[model samples]
Target: MAVKSDFLVIGSGIAGLSFALKAAEAGRVTLVTKMGPEETNTKYAQGGIASVFSDEDDFELHVRDTLEAGAGLCHEDAVRLVVTSGPERVRELIAWGVEFTRSDNAASNGYDLHLEGGHSRKRILHAADITGAAVERAVLAKVAAHPRIKVFDHHMAIDLITRRKLERRRKGKDRCLGAYVYDTKSGDVEVFVAGATLIATGGSGKVYLITSNPDVASGDGVAMAARAGARIANMEFMQFHPTCLFHPPRGKFSDQ
Candidate 1:
């Protein structure tokens, strides 16, 4: 029998969980992940999310810094939208119990904003060196307690189901129905039907032999979306972190 839900979300990272939380307000949500919910790239991220939180920081400066970092490839509208809405989103995260590191100064906003490369001001809101982990824990806790959300770990998505796969008459436009999910523990493929499906499997860092990303960052979402005939863009834009630490600390730095 096929499992049905109002919303089927693949992967349990910040994007997936955030969407699930909002979707639950309207109807039931089913969240599936290939590994444990915490085993995601977001949990391993050392740097914090960039947001304008300081009085010294302004939206234009943040957007300009982001554009410079993108090497002229960023969409101005998208950059503006993110920069403008970031502070509110960060505040929302804090309200949800994410304990960000605070400044020792008594007159500050209590947050110890960190400056990163290409930024004009201190705007990164972090929780020590494990900001992503802190955010993940808080969001996961809220998701676990939500009665409208159901979680399925160790479930891998095989492919998306579309109207054509159902063998029904051609509609006005092709619409996604759900996906075929592989339950790793049971070694069975199950049908997960939903009114809407969201894929947030993170990046494709695992595609490279050497990377700081977790094992789950295997580009599953991108692959699945491509297979479903989605239009992919800017795939050539690959980024490498210059400050990543390699194993065997005593080994030659160049070898890493």
Candidate 2:
């Protein structure tokens, strides 16, 4: 039997959950995660989101810092878009109940922004040390309460069902219909038919022997996309350890 919905979302990380929460406003959403939604890479992010929320920070400076950090690999358009919209988008997270840390009455809003290594100013808004966990919890709570959203845990998407798979390889841009999902618990494959499908599985950090990313971050979604002929590139680039330089009132060598 085929399960149908307005949107089929794979993976239950921040990306997947965020998209589903918004998409559910207009139509029904069916979200599937390979494992329980709580075991996501998003919770591992200790550092927090970067946005221009302080008096000293601005979009251009943030964009420049990001471009410099990327070492010329980041797309300029993408950088600009993210930098400009970052504050607003992060505010949306706040609206969704992400309790970003707050301190120092220096700023008007009183957010405890951190001076991350690459940034020229203090802009990283966090939730103490478990920033990602806080974000994930907030979004997950909202997603759970949403009436139009249905969640399926322990379901892995094996492959995307594209138009090419349905019909012959004719021309014109082929569209995606849904995916073939495998239920780990039931040990059966189900066809998910949706008007739109989104893949939000996190990075492939588990490819390495020793990694900080959880075992579930095995890049399965990337493989699924590649198998579906979705142009995959920049495979060489990988983040060994996303740096977050912690600097308290004093130094790192000794506790002041």
In order of appearance, the predictions have TM-scores of 0.92, 0.91
Please give the CA lDDT of all the candidate structures: 0.88, 0.89
Question: What tens-digit string does per-residue lDDT give for candidate 1 at 22-95?
Answer: 99999999999998888888898889989887777789999989999888889999999989999889888988
The total of clashing pairs for model 1 equals 0
For candidate 2, give the lDDT of residue 222: 94
- Which tens-of-lDDT digit does each residue in 50-109 have in candidate 2? 899988778889999999999979999999999998889998999999999888657726
Worst 10 residues of 2 by lDDT: 247-256
**Candidate 2 residue-wise lDDT at 170:** 48
lDDT for model 1: 0.88
**Per-model RMSD to reference:** 3.8, 6.7
Error of 1 at 87 (Å): 0.9
